[model samples]
Target: MDIRRWALDSDFKVTLTRPRFTDGLLLVLLIAITILSPRLLPVRSEGDTVLVRAGESVFRIPLEENGPHRVTGPLGEAVIMVRDGEAWLENTPCPLKICEAMGPVRRAGDVILCLPNRIYIRVEGREQTDAVSR
Candidate 1:
């Protein structure tokens, strides 16, 4: 019988498929995983290496050391300061001080980037990981 004919039939029988137990279980499992992933999954920690990027050049420095490193890019000079296992963008020629305002980042993937200057500071190879928030 054609579906169109069945639709027009006065005594046409129609039924809806009911969800199985496995389907409900799978849905609950997916929701649990999503809720717990953040607390269970690990985040990268602060590293001993600080990478200063200037245009096509990349300079790697030890984050454990205390000092200011200078990098030059399109906008001019920018400084990265490292003190007591923390690093931040000290100064940049960019009109917006957004990069400098990021303050000290001690986590592995944390970055201080100067868009106008094309400079970036990043950390790598640390023993401890970042907190759960990130």
Candidate 2:
């Protein structure tokens, strides 16, 4: 007979909960990954490693070495030199020697590519980034 009054008279206490890890196993995994992130990250180069990719193959050389290095690609050989603080493509056997014309690249991310030779060259450590976003 007094249904509305009965329902409205009831007092309730509401409680809040602190955020917690829903999955213990996942929480442990996340902790482990965070702890290992430093070692697992790609080694940051200081423009010290010169990388060359020729078709299916990749090669690396130290920029600190003051001398010329040669990498043979599909077309022929590309010669690169490293000096006091820079590295450059000396020559490439491709038709235009286009790779050689790229000039010296001292900064990281700088690249020289020869399409005919399937050769790609880049300096590592030119710039250090925590992560790349696309």
Candidate 3:
């Protein structure tokens, strides 16, 4: 039997095998893990703090403190201001300065990143169901 003749034969048929019981069980296990992973992980306690990172330095500032806190990065100074339970980037030495336009962050997990200056700012608190609702 020549390989080409067999491949081109008129009686040739191609079919997909049905999934076995073990395969179905594996799929169900995967779905369960995906649904439960987030709940299984420990949730951090809610806090009124903001975590700021610039280059090698890190600062934890309370959201209740209303002031412009400055941190230096590779480029220059980056000012993060906290007022009325919200934190935002007031100024950045980065070229684009897009981080400043991100608006205020009051809810937990909100982040303002300035990649050009290597700055990262995050608001810390209890996890919210979603960003839009929070």
TM-scores, all candidates, are: 0.60, 0.57, 0.60
Q: Model 3 segments beyond 4 Å from truth?
A: 1-47, 129-134
- The all-Cα superposition gives candidate 1 an RMSD in Å to the true structure of 12.0
For all the candidates, what are their Cα RMSDs to the real structure? 12.0, 13.8, 13.7
27-82 in candidate 1: lDDT tens per residue?
99999999998777565655788888889898888878899888889988888888
lDDT (0 to 1) per candidate: 0.80, 0.75, 0.83
| Stronger candidate by lDDT (1 vs 3) | 3
**Candidate 2 Cα outliers beyond 4 Å, as residue runs:** 1-46, 126-134
Clashing pairs in 2: 45-125, 47-125, 108-126
> lDDT, candidate 2, residue 12?
45
List, residue by residue over 10-62, the lDDT tens digit for candidate 2.
Answer: 67433445656776678899999999987787654447777888778887878
Cα lDDT tens digits, model 3, 33-123, are 9999988875544458999889998879998999999899899987888888888887677887789898888777888888988989887
